[model samples]
Target: MPLLDPARWRLLHGGEAAAVEPATGEALGTFTLAAPSDVEEAALTAARAQRAWATAPYSERAAVLRRAGDLIRRHEPEIGEWIVRESGSIRGKADFEIRTASEECYEAAALAHRPLGQVLPSTAPRLSYTSRIPAGVVGVITPFNAPLVLAARSVAPALALGNAVVLKPDPRTAVCGGHALAAVFAEAGLPEGLLRVLPGGAETGRALVEDPRVRVVSFTGSTRAGRAVGELAARHLKRAHLELGGNSAFVVLEDADLDAAMSTAAWASFFHQGQVCMTAGRHLVHSSRYDEYVERLAAKADSLTVGDPYREQVHLGPVIDRGHLDRIDELVRGSAAAGVRIAAGGRYRDLFYRPTVLADAGPGSVGASPAYGREVFGPVAPVRAFDTLDEAVALAGDSGYGLALGIVTRDTARALDLADRVPAGLVHINDQTVNDEPIAPFGGLGDSGTGSRFGGEANLDAFTETRWTTVRATPAAYPF
Candidate 1:
């Protein structure tokens, strides 16, 4: 049986919005367009089940997460297919998402065995300590670009830490992101009602945030939307962990290996059709090597193939949908109008947009180009030249976003210096910006987010609350 057999799920009746293959526009399946009432029901359900889950033995919680990881590996073929078709990811990228999601489960499993609290020194014949407790129900809102991994990163840790999750997956990727996870956890022996999959839009998300039962809201999406979610969560006094938008920079120094820099730059900007939040939106190359770098990068972009992942061997797949494709085109057109040279591609066939490179987008001209100035969530690389180290740092740090930054240089000292000067959360010395590991603290600063900082020990803080307790062997003398 298919993993997302809608009949086996608790789907609401008479809901609109069907999941479709973005490249082909074929109807894959329809998920319940969760209404506000549904969000209330899910939040209530999660709250009711959370007490027992929080009290469950550490071994039991760890076993559930380990089994979920195993089950995901066992069902890789089906899950990968769902991601490729539903989310418009290339075959290899689907595999990457599958692996990352599986790793997330494994990482979260470790959270159960870690030290939960600290023993503090006491002045008298008493003991003082701090214990961690679940934050109760957590609401997770994931976007369509990389649904499975994004959801898993938060969901797995939230569950392992003993908080129930109410997941609000993007309707465009509901099947792979929502139903697939629910099915895995169920088969892995997770208790019923601990995980609620609500696939929906802004209304559903707002409802989830507003639900009093949800103590925390973990959101991953555009910066604009993230701000709105953050505001709502704050008004309701809920902790919001936002992993938002980014216009990351890829810096290439004069002393860097040209071949390696060019290859890595292409991968950084064009990976997953550059729909990633950490996609290298700006290319900062030293003026001495700028011309050569743009030429090689544009050639590489031109050579990449774009099509339906299921049908061909393509490096890039279509954008999520037509609206996204049109937005990308508008940015590229505006960049061209602002005198940014379209060195390679600035076109598309249906939703399959060609990997594009915009050259000569310097500081003076970039202000007028939306592609360079904002987070254009598409496969458009805007290259700018910098003459000095200070200029490069200035260019990189000037953006309101500080998600990820990459510096390619043979001089380790220079690379380290640049990394220090930049305010991004993740920095790579000799590599590109689009990267993630379950063990690393993943987040950003400024408009990017309010520091989601999800992964490893950070998950403990994000999902649980700490309380101080003091004990005495005998009753202490009371002073009324």
Candidate 2:
């Protein structure tokens, strides 16, 4: 039987939603949409199951996660196929997602063995200590871009920490992101009801956040949506872990290696068609090399191919759907209208938007364009010139987002100095902006999110609450 077999769980409502292939506009399959009532039921079910799952042996929980990781690795080809066809990911990106998702499970398994509490000194004649306890049921809302890895990072850790999860994956990539993840857990012997996959839209996400039984909400999406989720979660008095959007900056110093820097910039800006939250949307190069940098980057962008990844060996796939394609096109066109020279690529065919580079997007002109500091989640790189380190730092931190920042220079000391002044949560002195590791804490600052980092030791803090306890051999005298 398939892991996503409808018989496994009750998907309320008589209607179904289609999961269409973005590249071909063909229906890959259909899934029942969960109503608000169904979300309520899922939370209740997860809460009930969490009681037993929480008390289960830590070894058992760890085993389940480890097995899931193995299963994902074992079925990489099959799952990769689903990701490519459903999410419009290039084959290389699909492979990266599979590998990273599996690593998330493996790392989460290790989380089971981390120190759960600490002993503290007490003022009285008593033993005092703190214990980390699960936060009951957790609500996870994941976006379509890089869904598998994003979902796994939260789901695996929540489960490993003894909390049940009710996942709401983006409906568009449900098959690869939602069903595949749940299937791996089921095959790994995870207890039923401990994890629920409810592929849905905003209504479903809101329902999950508002559900009383869900104590913690893990969300990954746009900054606008993340703000709403944070507000709603706060109104409900629940903790929300939001890893939102970014218009990250990639700074190139006069002393940097243009060849290597440009390569990193291309990958950072155009990887996965730049759907990533950490995409290097702004490029600040020193005035000495600004023109050369733009020309070389434009040539690189033009050399890359965009097509249906499932049928061709291409650098990039479709831009998720027509709506997303239109949004990217609008950004490029709007910037061009504002006198931002289009160094290369300002067009698209079907759903494939070409990788574009904008030059002469200085502080005065492009800064006024909508695509300047805004999160243009597409394959568009806007380059600006900076004269000194101070100006570069100012330009990089000018945006409301402070998710990730990159600085490339041979002067390690200067690069480190620049990193100190940047407001971003994650910074790379010698590398590009788009980077993630299962063991590293990942998050952003300001409008980007609440700075509730995820992964490694941070997962324990995000998924569990600390309870202080004290024991005494005799009762203390009371003032009564």
Candidate 3:
């Protein structure tokens, strides 16, 4: 009950709670962690709500979404601060998140009027038609990093598809996420129970995913948690969307402008202190420009000031919490022990790890070693130099995870070549792959994630499914 304490907003749903400290594995805050029985009650309430919600016309549903987006835009400054404080993302990073969230909401709202399907010209005297239909209810479990963007990406699509949504935000960032979203929709005159914001941790997520009423579970986070959610959803034969981990690489070819590469790397890996799943945690450069690139990158990286997220001069911020600081430290020491040159940084202050970079991060280099294979989930990138494009691509593909990758090059053919060879879902040329607009699809492949490409027109597929009802116009022939 301690985890459920109402220290913040009364969790969107009902429950008793307690405050506890996860950092020291002791109670630091009063919070109510969801219990199984409470979860069941919430699920029942959601199911009953969906029955009424599913009947609402798409146009009417879209109105609220449009207004919600409008409200978000009007309060960008306030919402931006919420994101920065909760995620510890820098001001620029937080602004980007807000923009991404707003854009996605607009697109989702517009989708309600878009054509769904075409009527086929039939040879026989019969009518044939197909169209997208809401999945009834969708469960969205968001991550702490860029909470608003991720939440919007999931919720917008479901709402556009006309599926009622129960958004469960990350406990760490819930203060602004679910509560703010709930406010926006309420302002838009959304029907009660149509779009709810429920905030909590593991138990809350588990309950939402396992609820039979939930038709789809859209999750973005670690592979371990995704797998657990997937298994649980599978037990009920439900559909699940998982956007998992990544250790994306930024590959700078010999022809790439060193300045541009450094700029891209600095933003990609350190923008949010490298908490983004698509952040370029690994930097692989061609040997010809490798030394020059790293020097420029280190210079630029070192110049970045880490301070309060709301400060304009600050390019970096705290690493979410102290646990992350320790994790970044482990990467530094482990890689150093592996004979990696600390290169740019391997120090820290409080929960902040100095803007760090590792070089000579070969297969054996401490930070570049196998230990850093998966998503580091922080702002510590290791530089790995290669002689050929083949070698660079190989290093980028070496990890089990494949979400996104970046390539800085001047040659058109070379960029395409690398994009073709890379295993990531999204690849960027001459810029950091982490740079994205909600208009474009973003997801992952392999261990990075297991979800359909979402965003744009295709996003409707994630929230709505297709079902064909065939009626033979002609009399049944023998065995027809």
Models 1 onward score TM values of 0.98, 0.98, 0.90
Q: What's the C-alpha lDDT at position 137 in model 1?
A: 97
Candidate 1 segments whose C-alpha is farther than 4 A from its true place: 365-367, 474-479
Tens digits of per-residue lDDT for model 3, 11-112:
434454432222223332343444545556655666677666667777786787788888887777777766666667777777787777778888888888
RMSD in order of candidates: 1.3, 1.4, 4.0
Q: Stretches of candidate 2 above 4 Å error?
A: 1-10, 364-367
Each prediction's number of clashing residue pairs: 0, 0, 30
lDDT of 2 by residue, 1-480 (tens): 334564443366625888888999998777887888889998999999999999999999999999999999888888898899999999999999999999999999999888989999988999999999999999999999998999999999999999999999998888788888998999999999999999877888899999999999999999999999999999999999999999999999999898788789899899999999999999999999998999999999999999999999999899888888898888888888888899989889999989999997755544467677578899999999999889999999898899999999999999989999989999998899989999999999997888999989999999999999999999988799
Cα error, residue 161 of model 2, in Å, equals: 0.3
- Candidate 2 to truth, TM: 0.98
State in Å the error of residue 62, model 1: 0.6
Positional deviation of residue 250's Cα in model 2 after best superposition, in angstroms: 0.1
List model 1 lDDT by residue over 1-480, tens digit each: 655577744476327777899889999866667888888888888999999999999999999999999988889999999999999998899889989999999999999988989999988888999999999999999999998999999999999999999999998999899899999999999999999888888989999999999999999999999999999999999899999999999999999899777889999989999999999999999999999998999999988898999999999999998889898999899889888899989989989999999998865544587899888899999999999999999999989999999999999898999889999999988999999999999999999999778998999889999999999888889787
CA shift at 417, candidate 3, in angstroms?
Answer: 1.2
The CA-based lDDT of model 2 is what?
A: 0.91
